[model samples]
Target chain A: MANPLEATVLVLGEQSEIFLGLLKKHFSTIYQLAHIENKEEFLKDNGAEIIAVATSNNVGMSKEMIDALPKLQIIASFGVGYDSIDVDYAKQRGIQVTNTPNVLNDCVADTAMMLTYAVARQLIQANTYVKKGQWTSSFPLTTSLSKKVCGILGMGNIGEAIAKRAEAAGMEIIYHNRTQKNHVDYQYIATLEELAKQADFLILALPSTGETQHIINANILDKMKPSAYLINIARGSVVDEKALVESLKNRQIAGAGLDVFETEPCTESPLFEMENVVLTPHYASGTHETRLAMAELVCENLIHFFNKEPLVTPL
Target chain B: MANPLEATVLVLGEQSEIFLGLLKKHFSTIYQLAHIENKEEFLKDNGAEIIAVATSNNVGMSKEMIDALPKLQIIASFGVGYDSIDVDYAKQRGIQVTNTPNVLNDCVADTAMMLTYAVARQLIQANTYVKKGQWTSSFPLTTSLSKKVCGILGMGNIGEAIAKRAEAAGMEIIYHNRTQKNHVDYQYIATLEELAKQADFLILALPSTGETQHIINANILDKMKPSAYLINIARGSVVDEKALVESLKNRQIAGAGLDVFETEPCTESPLFEMENVVLTPHYASGTHETRLAMAELVCENLIHFFNKEPLVTPL
Candidate 1:
């Protein structure tokens, strides 16, 4: 006598053990896999009916994998970014794709502000100095946010949140989004170049797509003030890594605080060698509270689907 | 004729070279005789009428130096911690004492939130593993901050600000202050012990004073939830460093995020050896914009005093 709730769940992305454990609680016979390069192996062995894919910009699922899953009814993503899972492809197969959105807004926003603070105050560098016993007399006097301009690119939920925190710190807020948001207090600009030229601190919060690729390149970097700082908590591909490295090297920009990079598990990036850059391994929505909420949301979405209920925060 | 503005200023404490350059812009004579173990040697060489002292808990100004400065009319301390400076002595001598107060409030609050996010998500530890080239495979599992109580000690300006940010993150706010503040919308507790026992995360935002010393001791730690975390961005002396080290060591507490310590240049502290604690050199308000504003405030105070006007933030 098999349980009526038994569903074969395929988890494609890595999650916190807590989250993974929670997923197992909801769905029976759960199979976990990270970057399933061999699609044939997954299809032949697991017999997955419902796939829950955890997507990041670094690791994405291929189009071929979707076609092979005969019993796949839903492609549940753990996060807002479905750039990993081909939405159009999944839609064509009568497969419903869902993502957890609006849950990570504050966490991502907090991370943006944290990166900005980390770079402006030299927290990471100072900690490193203290750890390395490099205290000759004192640490170099770092910058403050009392009179700085915080330029936010992509005036979405995360950008707005970062602006709120930065504004509370007495920073003048200016933003450059694709379209001007209505009834906003922040000064909006049409072009990234115009925003870069004006801002002392530029934050990239735009989603990554074809139009956004290499958005922050040599031409844009040239427009930025010499003392300006760049922070990217968004997708890594939105920035030109080589131009950023060159700008930091030539002192064209004061520094950069990067959470994401062109590659994940960044082992040998030139940006790491530069002291001006604070490199984090793309952990914008990384918080205990936020992650749990995200996991619960994923679980709720799966539960609703199984019970024939409407999706909450559908992609 | 000598320029009337050519003033000799006695500088105290450690300053960033950039900030020093800013100070030099206003005053002609900058006497940087920091760490003057020999009071007589410092006073004899620098015949300055105004002294700017910046002292932390470790390196404070001695009573002897204050007596030696016969012509000193103003003693402008570097930071808000005028506890190191004998304000009463200066007041008795009809000397004005000014400290940088409101300028640094926002930055400190920002750092508090930064530590809160970093610890909650295990960003520092996760990043450390990735940086050390230990990422053999993807490991997923992180703590979430949803539906948790954040107990704050000392609901001052910074604490209130942290509360606003925490509330935005959907955390339940409980606080213990000397007296309840009317402006904030948070649950108030009469004592820290009550707050500590209930909170999933206990944050120390109280000042370091005689009455508040070692307030978060072993007894208090014993009462706190075993899964709870402790964060201190306030003065280090407010929490018992030894008790905290043992709490984390014995797994009595989940983790700690500390910016300040019982001692500065805290190289030999046992907390550093543990993986459960996230330690940063006392740099809650170490942002460049904030530092410059503080420096400007100091310069303005000196200007106002010399002109026979009231000080901006006089003690």
Candidate 2:
């Protein structure tokens, strides 16, 4: 068995200082992928010694990178989503994978509710109106979220949390999932088309998979009510950005509140110029409290894997 | 008794078309205060014929204005708050007062929660950052509202509604009212100072009264944690604007989410420049759905008053 303290762990991306400190506490040899100027030479010389890899959803390990790490035993991701990581390839190699889930559910759910409220209530535009000395005149009345339908896609733990908050806001919940969930009493719509047609706010909370990529295409967009809002806190690939841009341009949908995009760290997009949409930089789970918990969980998973114990949240 | 359709109603301010339509349907003689350029002359000629006054919280009936109309039996206001109206003087004259209250609770509560989530999560700024093509870098982690103390002042219907949403968001609810109520399970802090000191978000949801004016002065603001936020969905007079400005300037409090202002339609203030605050133009219940309900209720109260029935929502 590899010595837990001496095992080389390759950190693939920039992480919080706290996460790095925790990683250092558990392992002596920590190699940052960014620090390696000649990656090919570095992997040739030292990749054999790298027993573990640490990454996040944004900076996922690729198949080529996985192939380079001959002795990679585990891939511990810092976020709930592992779609970016080649999980199937890792599984085929008998390597384990773990993610920091449940810890981020609250923050992500809060983001969904926040986005829904912001878009429906015109919070950002209203604030800007006030700041611009436009309050001297009566501001236009906005749409109310209360007593409206909140159609959730992917009725998972995070979606359930979002539903709880939405219900408290007096919104009725309906959802669409591959299989109906018995635990929740919220009405289940059989198809995405029905959910889109009925929803005042269609929130995307599903994972990113090959099947889910571009799930919200032009056809789905056309089914949504012109007054309905699209709130995406899920993986960006779930939505076809081109179709969304076209929808917004033509006023096919009222607006969107997006925390994720097809290409993350998206510097420019047509959505930026549209006042109807509210965009966040893929920051659904970005909070001081939640990030600390998620980072701690990632470290724990890595530590537990090296100790040959059960993984905290193995996928 | 005056004929139901013939009784004259003097509408004191601009109103929604729906409200005006309803009023016109009930009363044949409907006089708009704005159209009467010579109000004193017009009142001298026709005030005795005015059986009832229809006004709004913004344009309230003053003592002098009430005195002008000798036959006035009731004042029907279009909003929940009646602080702008001289209720005591009207009561002394044996005149009844009515406001649209219960109809607007949900939208106002929704606004309170929207402001809270927006301020705590930095939603507005985050949205702007992404729009400004600044998403190439990681956005800053914001404070989370979950597991934090939400201190409410004035636990009325709207306050209770706000508490419900806050609870769903995973916040611990504490409140300070004039006296502790037996109906609620939330902890009641007898004093305002203690609640301010303990709260992560100090939300003001009380009615505006003489005794409550400037209640959140420098002393109360000074008692608040620097990390705590102030959310005022109640009347603006409930807070001392000058004191709040000073507190925010000095970083004594984290931020504020203001839906009302001391002097409304206020075009200029130091707060306009502050990025830490989220300001709305006194539009808490300013949704098309809620405003229509409020307007209809105002009309109903007027109809009920002239018909010798109980007022829909008597103040």
| Candidate with the greatest DockQ versus the true structure | 2
lDDT value for candidate 2?
A: 0.92
Per-residue lDDT tens digits for candidate 1, residues B30-106, read 77766468756767766455454433333445566677777677877667666667777877878777888877887
Q: Tell me the tens digit of each residue's lDDT in model 2 across B1-315.
A: 334476678999888777787788778789998888998899999989887899999998899988999988999999899998999999999999999987888899999999999999998899999999988778888988899999999999999999999999999999999989789999999899999999999999999999999999999999999999999999999999999999999999999999999999878999999998999999999888998888878877888877789888997
Tens-place lDDT per residue, model 2, A54-116, is: 998888989998999989999999999898899999999988999999998888999999999
| Per-residue lDDT over A198-224 for candidate 1, one digit per residue giving the tens place of the 0 to 100 score | 998999988888789999999999999
TM-score for each predicted model, relative to the true structure: 0.85, 0.97
Q: Which 10 successive residues of model 2 chain B have the least lDDT summed?
A: B1-10
Q: Residue B129 lDDT in model 2?
A: 97
| DockQ (CA atoms), all models | 0.38, 0.86
The parts of candidate 1 lying over 4 Å away from their true place are A1-24, A27-61, A69-73, A286-289, B1-61, B69-73, B92-95, B144-148, B164-170
